[model samples]
Target: MSFIRGKKVGGVIYYSEVENVRVNGKVVQKHIRYIGRDKDNPDHIPIEKVHFGYIATRLMQGDLSPSELFGMIEKIGSHVNRENLERIGLFYDFKKNSFSLSLYRKRLSGNQKDAEDVKKG
Candidate 1:
């Protein structure tokens, strides 16, 4: 299962997604995705807002379970209201207690590309 991990470097904390995988008959942690820096720091570089599509994609790929995804969302301080979910081609199924992508994926206007730049720096 994937979960958020924080590593400190040069007195700054950087967070990312990581999971355990079997490698050469040994279980090891593999880096999944770079999330962002500690938001509480003054020098923190803000990354793009987490969208419903990202969560849905990860969920569908089995990278994150429902509870893990929700925990990550809560840790990141993201808002997951119904209107916001529909805006990004996602919806929460109350019956199934899970999130699913909609037929039409609506792209939002924002600094979606900024996260890549931040990761590079």
Candidate 2:
């Protein structure tokens, strides 16, 4: 599995995807992809550099702070609301102020194919 790794060089923090592999009878960490540095806003990483899966994971795990979460959702333009989040297999509990992956992800109710299939033999 590949995960994000961070390093500081010349006063800039660089992020990259790294993975472990065996070579020469020894296991070593290898850099998979160079994700870039956030020069201006340290808190804001380029959205293109990060995968959607990571964002979803953070949101579900409550790893992101309120401002960070809202900023990320706005930057991603993912339309994260109760209805949309639920539609995409995520749960947002307003009362508890929590986000998580839904156990009972509901399927789209008005699919044309499903309707047609039901009418056929």
Candidate 3:
């Protein structure tokens, strides 16, 4: 399973995706992806306000289905449109009433190399 976790470095809190994987007989939390910095911090990086990591984590864990996730988004009144969703690797198909994850587009603005590494793995 995957979840969002925050780690503090140099007085700033950065968030990332962590997944529990069993290696050789022990379970360990592996770093899946870097999400973003805490916006509440003074040195926070100016990224989009959308909680992409949280949403993606929930979706990947089957905590919520795609349509249900969108419903929650609509309730929150976030300005997350198709383009923003695509940027985070979520593709919604209206005709099929489903969505897909595009690993290529999932990484944030500057994590191209990490995304490639995830693909290779």
Candidate 4:
């Protein structure tokens, strides 16, 4: 169950790497990945990670949407198995762009303190 639309909620996601707690609002979706043995025809499993990040280049100019962020996370979930993927949707406000691994586009940001606190209990 997700409390993204109406319910006022915030909780911790136990990813493979750093555990991250949602600060103000919960993500809009759950199980947003397509990973498995099959590359062409893949299967998705339920996964949650915190404080993870990946590198992504700015393809279009616009604000990173919640869904897009989640999808991006899912895509690279395997790479950052132990860490939160942060660079994929990480975008620069002025340039209206996102992050990238191969290209130097923007810096992926996250609140490590919050993630640690949440993991500590």
Candidate 5:
């Protein structure tokens, strides 16, 4: 379900890890992680970068609770995206136009504010 995709643009080859998913009965390919360009050694990918898809998979498997998941997301900040969760096997019900994480909002919101306050101080 996951594979490498490569594209060449102006002599630079870029690659990404992609996953296939079914959306509205249509199979769509989504990018998981930007693996970097051929010009740059992919093996040397930065340590600071966290793959949200992998974390999402852990959360889906219940290996991490929703509060832990949200904490990781807040730590990663902008790097998190809906696509990452979908690639990790989450699905969106377009008819409902909703996600199920509302159950976690109450659990995580308070802790998140405390974390923010600690960071600010």
Candidate 6:
């Protein structure tokens, strides 16, 4: 697992992957934070201040998009009238791949090149 730092915006927390780290000898896939609504005990927190573990967990899973995640909470009866805040959070999800801003950028550039190469190949 890797620990990453994210920046906070209005209300949403944005987690930018820091480094690839190992946790309990397992590789972390992704990292994220909950912005609106408490996943575990929705009633425990106020409607505006809700985000909980569930949202964070979902982000880690990479299944739900930031917008969709918040929409789900609202659909379920939670109310959050705000934009996605860019809050900084920690991320520790990496197995073999070391996650650094430079590395990530390089990989993306490489991927684009690879795609071009594939067309020529």
Number of clashing pairs per prediction, in order? 0, 0, 0, 16, 0, 25
Q: Model 2 RMSD to the real structure?
A: 16.2
- Candidate 6 — which residues are off by over 4 angstroms? 1-54, 88-121
lDDT of 1 by residue, 24-87 (tens): 9999999755555532221111223245556756867878764575465556665333222222
lDDT to native, each model: 0.52, 0.53, 0.53, 0.35, 0.50, 0.43
User: Which residue runs does candidate 4 get wrong by more than 4 Å?
Assistant: 1-59, 79-119
Spell out the clash pairs found in candidate 3: none
Compose the digit string of candidate 2's lDDT tens values, residues 54-119.
767786897866557556656765333332122223444466554443222234556854874687
Candidate 1, residue 59: lDDT: 62
The runs of at least 3 residues in candidate 2 whose Cα sits more than 4 Å from the true structure, single-residue gaps closed, are 38-121
Error of 4 at 68 (Å): 0.7
For model 6, what is the alpha-carbon lDDT of residue 73? 59
Please tell me which predicted candidate would have the highest lDDT against the true structure.
Answer: 3
RMSD of 4: 17.6
Model 3 has an lDDT value of 0.53
Q: Against the correct fold, how does model 5 do in TM-score?
A: 0.34
The TM-score of predicted model 2 comes to 0.31
In order of lDDT, best first, we have: 3, 2, 1, 5, 6, 4
Per-prediction TM-score to the true structure, in the order listed: 0.34, 0.31, 0.33, 0.20, 0.34, 0.26
Indicate the worst ten consecutive residues by lDDT in candidate 1: 39-48
Of models 4 and 6, which has the larger TM-score?
6
Quote the positional error of residue 27 for candidate 3 in Å: 1.6
- Displacement of residue 75 (Cα, Å) in model 3 is 16
* lDDT per residue (tens digit) for residues 1-121 in model 3: 8887889999868787789999999999997545455322111111222555567668688787756755665565532333223323554556545443332223355576577569879
